[model samples]
Target: MTQMTRSAVGGRLSDDKRKAIALQALARTESIRVLAERNGVSGPTVKMKTCMSRG
Candidate 1:
């Protein structure tokens, strides 16, 4: 698998912050792709964040 650069990893946001943002975005957006694009992150990353937050 390809590795993400630090910036591409959304390092500016802490895990807690990322989860909060992901949750809010997931609630408001129809597509994870669009939310990830808007937040400068990968869709799988956002999906993982949501899953992590839940579990």
Candidate 2:
């Protein structure tokens, strides 16, 4: 599998923050675009977090 590198955004999201984002993403409770925008992360980053949660 390919390594997943984080984006060079303003700063890194804390572990708790990442978990929170991943939870909401995996739960399918909100739109990915909205979540990414609100969290200041790229859409792909959100998807990557959810994918990482799989393992």
The CA lDDT of each predicted structure is 0.69, 0.78
Point out where model 2 deviates above 4 Å.
1-6
Please identify model 1 stretches exceeding 4 Å from their true place: 1-7, 25-28
Candidate 1 lDDT for residue 11: 65
What TM-scores do the predictions have? 0.64, 0.79
Candidate 1: clashing pairs of residues: none
lDDT tens digits by residue: candidate 2, 1-55: 1123325551478888888889999998899988887787877888888999989
Candidate 1, residues 6-55, lDDT tens digits: the string is: 24567677777797766866586568777776677777777877777677
How many residue pairs clash (N, CA or C atoms closer than 3 angstroms) in each of the candidate models, in the order given? 0, 0
- Pairs of colliding residues, candidate 2: none
User: Model 1, residue 41: what's the lDDT?
Assistant: 73
Query: How many backbone clashes can be found in candidate 1?
Result: 0
